[model samples]
Structure formats: C-alpha cells, structure tokens
Target: MKRILVLLFLVLCYTNPSVAQLKKVTLEEIWSSNFSPERLESIRSMNNGNQYTLLKSNPNNLFSAIEKYDYTSLQRIETIVSTEDNSDIPYFTTYLFSEEESAIILGTQVEKVYRRSTKGIYYTYDLANKQLKQISDQKIQEPSFSPDGTKIAYVYRNNLYVFDRITSNRTQLTFDGLENNIINGIADWVYEEEFYLVRAFEWNSDGTKLAFLKFDESEVPVFSMDRYGEDLYPSQTVFKYPKAGETNAKVSLQIYDLVTENMDLVSLDSPYYIPRLEWRNNPDDLSIHSINRHQNHLKLWSYNVLTKKLSLLHEETDKAYLKIKDDLTFLPDDRFIWSSEKDGYNHLYLYSKEGELLNQITSGAWEVTKYYGYNPETSVLFFQSTENGSINRDVYSITLKGKKKKRLSSKSGTNSADFSSNFSFFINTYSSANTPPIATLNSADNGEEINVILDNALLRTKLLSYEISPKEFSTLSVNGNDLNMWMIKPKNFDPKKKYPLLMVQYSGPGSQRVANKWNNDNDYWFQMLASNDYIVACIDGRGTGFKGRDFKKVTYKELGKYEVEDQIKAAEELSKLAYIDEQRTGIWGWSYGGFMSTNCLLKGNETFEMAIAVAPVTSWRFYDTVYTERFMQTPQENPSGYDENSPLNYPELLKGKYLLVHGSGDDNVHVQNSMRMVEALVQANKAFDWAIYPDKDHGIYGGNTKLHLYTKMTNFIMKNL
Candidate 1:
C-alpha cells in the first residue's frame, strides 16, 4: 500500500501542470540582460592609425580580453591579449595599451580609496615573447606607460615611482610623500571629485620629464567612519574630507626630471587650484588649468620645463561658478580648444599658444554636452549638444573657425558616437525611452549605419511580455517657467478610479532626471510599480542642466529653495488630475534628490503625504566644499541659507509616513547627515522607519541589496501611501 502511494505521488508530480510551481523572479534576471556581447569601453586608436583596441568581457570564460578591431570594417580581427589564456596572470578589470602596442598594463584587484581614487594591482603583458610582468607586487594608482613605452610610472604610498621594463628596476622620485602631508603624482579627495582628475603625472612629449601635482593636507581635518565588520573589533577608515566651511588641501605643481632624478616645485604667483595639467606640443612646454578658491575665476598657464617658468595664457571669469570641461585639447600647432560659459551658454573657444582668442567655435542658446576630439587632419571638431532639445543629445561637427556646422547623427533620440582613429568611422550608441540601446558602426562624414553591434532584441521581447506603460513626456509650467516631466501610468489605469502617485527626482545642480534615454535598473523597478497599479512621475526642476547657465545657476546662494518650490507646485498641479489620488501621494529621491524630497515633505507638508530619503544631506553645511559652495557659497556667509532650508530644523512638519534609508559607508554624503536628521525626528517624537545598510556606499548596490531595498520600499508604499 505504501509503494502504491509513492507511485501515485510521483505520477501526480510529473503529470499535473499545477504540481510544479513557477520560478520566483530573481533580482539577477530582472537586472541582467542577454544583449549581444561585444568589445566596447575604453576604446583607443592604435598609433598605427588604422586599428583600435576595446575591452571585451567573456561571460562564459569569466574573464576579460583585449580585442583589436579594424578601422575600415569595424571587425574584431584578433584578441591581442586574454587573461584566460595565461595561467600566472589574474583577470583585470581594466587595461591600457602602450604606444608601441608591445606591452599592455592590466589593472586588477582594485580597491576604492576614496571618491575617484582607487588602488589596483598592475601587470604588463609583453606581446613579442608572450610574457607577463608585474609592475609592482603591491597595489598602485594610475599606472601609465612612458612616451617611449619603455617604462611604467605610477603612484604608490603617496609617492611617484618609475619601473624600467628592460632592467626591472624601480626609481623613487619623491621621498617626502606622506599621508596628509605630501602627496605626489595623485590628487586629493576634493580635487579628484570636483576636478575629475585621477592621474596627476604627465609624461613630457619626448618622454624625458614627468610633471605632477603634490597636495599638502596636513592642516586638513580628518573625518573618520567606523567600519563594523564580522570581526570582534570594528575598524576605522579615516581620511581628510573638507566639509562646506572646512580647510582644503594645499596643492602645488611639481616637475620631475627622469634623467637626473631631480624634482622641483613650480611657483605660481596667485593662490589657485590646479585642476588640470597636460603636456603640450612642445617637448618642454606643459599646460595647466587653475581656478580660484571661489571657482569663478580660471587661468590657463603654460609651464616651460627647461626654464622652470610659468606664463599665463588666458583667463576666464564669470559672476557665477565657472564650468570645467574635458575638451581642453591642445592642437599640433600648439593652439588649443576650450569650452566655457562666459557667453551665458556653453560654447567652444579657440586660443593661440600665446593666449590670443582666435574665434568662438560654437554659440547658441543650447549647451554642448560633450566635446569629442578634433580631427586635426580634417580640421573638424566633433561634439554633442542639446540643439534639438535640452533632454535630447545629438552629435554635431564644426570647423575650427566655427564655420559650416553639420549634424552627424540623423537619429532624433539620444545619439553618441565614438570615432575611430582616422575619423573615417564611428560607433554610435543610440537609444530612446521606448527603445532599448542600439550600438552601430557608421560613417563619420555621412550618418550611414554599417553594422549593428548590439540590438538588445531578446531583452526587448521579454520586456514586452509584461504589462508596461508608456513614458508620457510633457511640460509643466511652474514659476512662469516650463519644466520637463515624464509620467508612467498604471497598466490598468482607470480615469474614474483614482490611483496613488509616486514622484522621483534628482534635483542636483546641472542634473536632468527626465530625458529621452534607455532604460536602467531603476526603470525596471518603476515598471514593477506600474504593474502593481501605481503612477510614477519625475520632473526636471530648476537648476537641472543642459538648459543654460542661467537656468542651472539660478539656485545660487539657495540650494533647496527654488527646487523644492518647483517640485511641490508641480506635484500640486499634478494631483489635480482626475486619475491621481491627491491624498495618497508620495515623493522619494537619493542624494541631492533626497535633500529635495525631505524638504518637500517638511516645507510642502500638505502636498506630499510620504517621503523616502536615501543618503540625504540634512544640511548644506555637511556637504563637500566644492559642490555646496559652488551654489550656496560658505555657510559662514550664508547662515540663514543653510539653517532655514535644512529639513532637520523642521522635523515637526513630517506629518505623513517617512522612511529614511542610508548606507553606513556613504563617504560622499556622510551618514552623519542622515543620523542628525534621525535624531531630530526622534526628539520631535515622530515615528519613522529607517535602515542603515552595512558596508554599503552611496550607490547602495550589491548582492541582493538593491532588490531588498526596493522591496522594503514597495511594502512601505503598499501599507502607508
């Protein structure tokens, strides 16, 4: 009888349709996609000028391979180097090819030191003998090949060192480099974040000298965070982080002679921040871009290595903060191209080697979003701008004299191009809200698609299987200004039955939340919300970028005031819709948007019913000096601006449900910001839900962590809002 019962159960399990259950959707499947795999990022043209190499990841092999592609046909001809083929070498996250293409520097085992600062183990791959050589047994930062490709220069232990590939000998250039005292060949935390500089050393045109920036941060106060691990005792990760009104690291320029092993400091007459440095066309001449403490004044100076003298070439000033661009390209003739907002909009400028302004390359109400390199042979400058609309980006080209402007991308959506070595071909990455990202090789002169690299057809088909809503793009009028907004209604949306609303935003200065772009991880979560019957919306408030300088800088001396007003007013108007539930409304944001959301819940208490703030700055005084002071100046100068607008000062106004989330290891906006707000709410006897993720950074992404966070947030919304 028991044998018969077991046989019957086995038959039922195999034959019955409902016996086997459907698989619960894993976060990995929801986040990952089966798009066409190809070599893509960190693309650079070989010195031969006919070939280029791209970093390729092989999922099956679980390793990275450097593949070289032909310039004409855009075909991956061969794998230059593959970590899987070697037994001794480890897999690298990133790599750089030397000028001669004989050696490749592989970066692996990377550990984040600070914002934009990383330490990694480097290995040199030799092509001739198929040998792999380790540059250093220890981790290092920003390893670069010499101009001759014979030696590798890097920064380790806060000092500069050069390793000879032939002799396997190491030479230390600066012995005075110490933590919080003398930093050689690398930038500090603030400079790295604000200036976007990582590698501080520059190789001279002839490979005879190296120029670097040394930061003296002894006077800077140290900010420490407790790291609670599984170990018995918690560790401390302490570093010098300058708050809004705190002291910054003193930076200076230094030059190192490779032949003599001698280092000397370059003297600049004015006190300024050396944001960028590069070797010019002349072997002995180097260009440095510096800004004042206020960041409104900028000066471009040339340093002659032979004479050890500095000459100011050009100066740019504005009433508002000066924008830093990566388009400072030096021409073969020593002339350079730089972009500035001095004309109220970002435009390109051409300057002579001696600081004479030649002509403006671009001018309009729109802003240039990207500056692709200039084709020196053809004299064409490639760039992407918002000429079509502020939310859209399209590629364009103009001559060096600012004449004969031509649009290279014919697509109406977001189109970005990565040109090849000889400017004959370019790889275009195009996408829109309704479409998945598509990458294709196209002719640079005429926008004709040649071949498709990634179409993401399978993912799109899978996405279509679920109930999804279209992202309805519209404009809202607030404070006599038109602001862009996008809304996603419920799949089974009914105009007669009101539905709850959830608004999202990232209201940082020069930021755009509503754009014609491809879907991200956040979009998938939003789709889940839409499927569950919720209205998702986002608005680009004032201070968002790509509009113009006036629109972005209007929040000067007032960070959250105008942004909160616009968002609240926009939400109020949105709630008037017959399909939206006015009473069941909520707002949530991360980082800057978190600041905006918290302020909205407090200041606009009647408008939004609930708000979730993730890693938010409760007060402007707690933010970094460069970002905060760019708009609000110093807290000493603007005390009321900092206090009156702080959400921590008005905890009593949190009338609705509030869920505050932050990561304990958020170095960008210190967890202190959220902790202070939590204390304030507790003191006011306000009930709220808050969670601190262990060892998570500002991004808050890790193994099942993002899914759990969103699930928690979803549960909160279902119960409260």
Candidate 2:
C-alpha cells in the first residue's frame, strides 16, 4: 500500500497545471517578437472622419499596399495604392497627404541618421492623374509639401532646396551651407540632441515666405568616436558637440521670399536657445520662443511682417527653471492656448494674440499631461490629464470655459487617445500592468464606444502558457513623500522564504518608472528574472514627475543629490521586508538611472550589494548645454553642484559587485561617461566588470544585441546575487 501511494503522489505532482504545465520564459523568446502584441501599422485618419488608411503587407511579404477602411464597420473600403498592382513605385513605407488630400508622397529606401532624423527616397503620387514621380534622385531629409501643395521643400547636404512638383524644377534657396560650419534649414548636433528640433524651417500659411534657422557651428568643439565595423582597421565619426559651459553654435533666423527672391535675417532678443519658432494665423505674424541659458526666464516674441516690428506676447518665469514644450496653439482669431506650471500644476490658459491675459481654461491640483487639438466647430477642447490618478492617464474633453468636462476613457490604466482628422471620433488605447492593449473607437461627444478595433486577445491567451505574476502596486513614504512603487514577486512566493531582490529605475528629473501601462520589453525581461526566483521592484522616488511641479523641480541645480539619496534610502527601507534577502540586494538603471545606480552602490553600500549601470553620465561637465545647463545651470556658475553629485569624483567608496556597460556609438550620452567611471574604479583597485558595444547607439538595441545584453546581465545576477 505504501509503494502504490508514492507512485500516485508522483503522478499527481507531474499533472499539476499551475506548476508543471506552464513553460519557463527564455531570454531569446523574450527579446524576440514572438510574444509581441498585435497593433495597427501606420494609421492615417482621413478628413472625412469615417475612413482611415492603413499600410499593410501581404502574407507573401513580396508586396506592400495602402488600403482605406470604414470606421464604423471596420471593413476595407478601397485600396489606395499597391505594389502588386499597377502602382509604379515599389513598396512604399511612409505616406504624407497634402492639405487638400489631392496628392500623396511615399518614402522608400529610407535610412535613419539619428534618433529623430531620417534620409529617404521620396516619390509624389498624384491622386487625380495617377502619376508617380520621384522628388529627388538622391536621398533627402524632411521632405514636406507646401501649404498649397504646389511645391516640396527638403534638406540635402546641409542646404535647403525647393522642388516645383508641377514643372519638376529645383531651386536652391541657400548657397552658404557647408559640412559642419554652416547648417541651413536644419538643426546641428547640439540643437538636435537637446532642443529636439531637426527640420529647422517652417512654411507660412500662404506658402510665399519660408522661415528657417541657420546654425553656424564654426566655434563649437567637435567630438569623435571610433566606429569598429567589419573593416580592416576602423573609421571615426566626428561632429560638433557643445559640452557644458562651452561655446555653442551661433543660430540666426532667416526668411526667404519665393516670389521676389529676397532673403533677410530677423533680429530677436533670444540669443541663448531658440527652441521654438512658429507662424501665427495671419500668415505674416511669426512667433519666436526663447529662453536664457539657465532656462528660468522664457519669452515669446511675435513679429509682424507688414509692420516689421517685434513685440513680446508672453513671458514665463520660475524659481527653478522653465520647460519648453510643443504646446503653443493659435486659434483662428489669434488667441492661443498655453500651458504653464505657474499655479503649482501644469494648467491651460487662453491668451490673446496681442499679449493680453484672457482666462485660465483648466485648473486643479493635477497636471494636464497632454494637450490634444481643439475643434472649432464644437468649441470643445480634447486633452489627457492625471485627474483620475497620478500613475493613471484618462482622456477628457472640456469647453473653453472649462465646463461640462467628460472623461472619454473609462478604464483605470493608461488611456492614450488618438483623434480622427475631424475630431468626430477618437481611438482610445487602454492598457494596465496586468492587461494587454485594447483599442476601441470612441465618439467625441458623449464618450460612447462606436467600434472595437483591436483587442489583443491572442497575446493574452499566449501569455497564459508562461508562468506570470501581476505587478503589485503600492506607495512608499520615503524622505517625507509618498513615492509611487511597484514590485513583481515570484509567482509561487512564500513569505517564509527569503529571495534576492533586484530594483530598477530611471530616476531622471520629470521622469516616472512606476506607471500603469502594459509591459514593455524591459518588463518582459523583469518577468524572466522573477521566474528565476528574484523579486523585482521599481520605485519613483523624489525628483520624479506626475505628482506636481514642486515634486519634480526639487532636485534642480543639484541633479543627482536628492534623487540618489532617495533611492539609497528606499532600498534600505525595502530591505526590512519579510521576504527580502537583505544580503543580496541589487539595483540597475540606464542613462540617468545609471547615474543613480552607481551612486547607490557607492553611498548605500551597506544596503545594496550589487549594481549595473548602462550608458551612465559620470559627470555633468560631459553633458550638453541645453539639457544639463537647464537643470544644473553652468559648471562655472555652480561648480559644487556639478562636482558633488557626479560619481566620477568619488569611486573609492565602491565595495560591491558593479557592472558598467556602454555603446561606443552613443552620440547622446557619450561613451566617455562609462570610460571615466571605469578608470576611476580601476585606480581605486575596485573589482568590477565592464563592456562596450561596438557601433551601437544609445538605445543599445539591434539584432542579437538586446538578447546578448540581457543574457549577460542574467548570468551576472545568477553568479553574484
């Protein structure tokens, strides 16, 4: 009887669905697209509000096509163009419709230059005549149609040119453009990296005048990196990069007249950073937004073409520093919508075009996260905010007076709304930490569901085959603030057993890691770590965003001081948990988080036992001006602030297992950061491991790149922790 009972118990254990039936997730499958969620590809809403276009590939993968679908029925209405049919161009990837929808331009043979810049072969398709024409034989950047759809303007080899789509004639607008000294109609390296402006030109409403930025980088210093590819030796990629307190490129605003062939420069008071340049509704009035080097004083100057005079429209000042964003919108009458943090929260306000204060549109303790476009026909403004919760986002609509506000998204997770061209309908993408993305069409008026677009049910069913654990969300009161946090415990967690802990964060200013969103690629890797019996936790400590302006700007002028303190203390406090193994605590982060993780392992050596830093900034002096100067002023102005928080100044405190990884081709956060840290630790006789990915960018993602990185990290964790 005893032998029979033992055999039955063994058979029952093998048949258990929760333990034996689920498969373990592998690093290869996690980094691969095997478990990726289904999504809409290149969606373009038509002006009719009832139809939208989609770029889809056939099953054979030999041809690609653009097709239109009805919004209500979710059925294909017509095929716009196809490579398999009579379409002349081969497999276009991107499309741009003219203002009147009379023509479309497709981009093929595309190549990326940076994070936000690209070069491509462009072709224009006439919808009425069904003619396909190439704009340029060579690759160009930022090919845009004029307001009237008669001409196309693009940048090539640091110069600006205009192509007449009808006559097929090209006109070079600027002739002084050179390789690195003079950049016409395009942002230089520093401006592109920090200010987020690439195509440094804009066409007016009438399309007769073109306003563009000219960057003269003759005095700025250049940085170079050795690119080791499949070559005999190696090549070097060098570009102008202005570090902190260094001389920046001389930028000027110029306007070119197409009719008279006259070009002239505009004189403005914004000498430090010209972040934004926009044209008003009158076709002649142009707005120039500027801020000082400290970024505390910002002014919006308006210039009138007829009067030829510049006037200040508005100005914003803050105790810490002001943030420049793409939120300036002008109504038909020239009254504009502006968002500011003057009231301790980012709220919207209406301002007359003549610099008069009108009224505040929205007001509350919470911040308006997104400012959607306004519909003049219904007088309703759509936006997204944190009124529901800080970690959650919801869609909302309000009138000009901030009345009759309605929440369009009902789910409690992250809800991002993409409106149709006419604002008659919007597609709301809802996701939570425990749920996949579900997209549905919502009516703009009463927030009613019109149709279900994609639910991602297949991804959810596929995820059930693996051992998964839902992330536990909570709050940690550290340093007199209720910091938001989340933790992923082992699937079969037991309180009596102690498990190693690994914490991840990206504790940059105005950044958040603990949010209610679906899993990213990192989350899948975290789940794989959790399956290996490690408790993964993430915290949004002080200096993180979404709470209010005060909470975010507290670390200003001292970028890594309070942030590192919070992380160290938070780890110390979390070690007191019953299920946490205090002896084997580890932390890791990328970029800004890497900076913090390095400091935590040094300053909090009593608490954290290991750390991994990827592409970290070792010192503020090596960072750019627009971003680093905005937070910490200048190294000359605040030397102590820069030197005190930088990890390069103090490496003798290291006493734990440390892994530093970087990419040689990281133009944003240069590889010098990790190299300096490595030298410092090496001189201190601290034992550590470091790696460099050859010819990889800051994201460090490519074929077999992420898989190899995560596998190395997993092996390190298993060996050390």
Q: Each prediction's TM-score against the native? A: 0.94, 0.97
Residue-wise lDDT of candidate 2 within 1-721, one digit each (tens)?
Answer: 9999988887876676454567767888977777788775657899887888998765456577788998778899998888877647677778899887888888888888888888899988888888888999999998888998889899988899998989999999998988769999889887777778999999889998889999999999999999999999999998888999998899899888899898978888856778789999888889998888889999999988768898999999998999888888999889999999999999888898787888888889898999988998987899999998899999999998788899999999999888888899888889999998899989988789988888999988788778788999999989999999999988888999999999999999899899999968788888888988999999998888989999999999998899988888888888999989899999999999899899999988888899999999999999998889989989999999999988888899998999999999999999999999989998988899999999998999889999999888889988998
TM-score of 1: 0.94
Residue 226 of model 1 has an lDDT of: 88
Off by over 4 Å in 2: 1-20, 58-62
Candidate 1 lDDT tens digits, 554-583: 988888999999999999999999999999
How many clashes (backbone N, Cα, C below 3 Å) per candidate? 0, 0
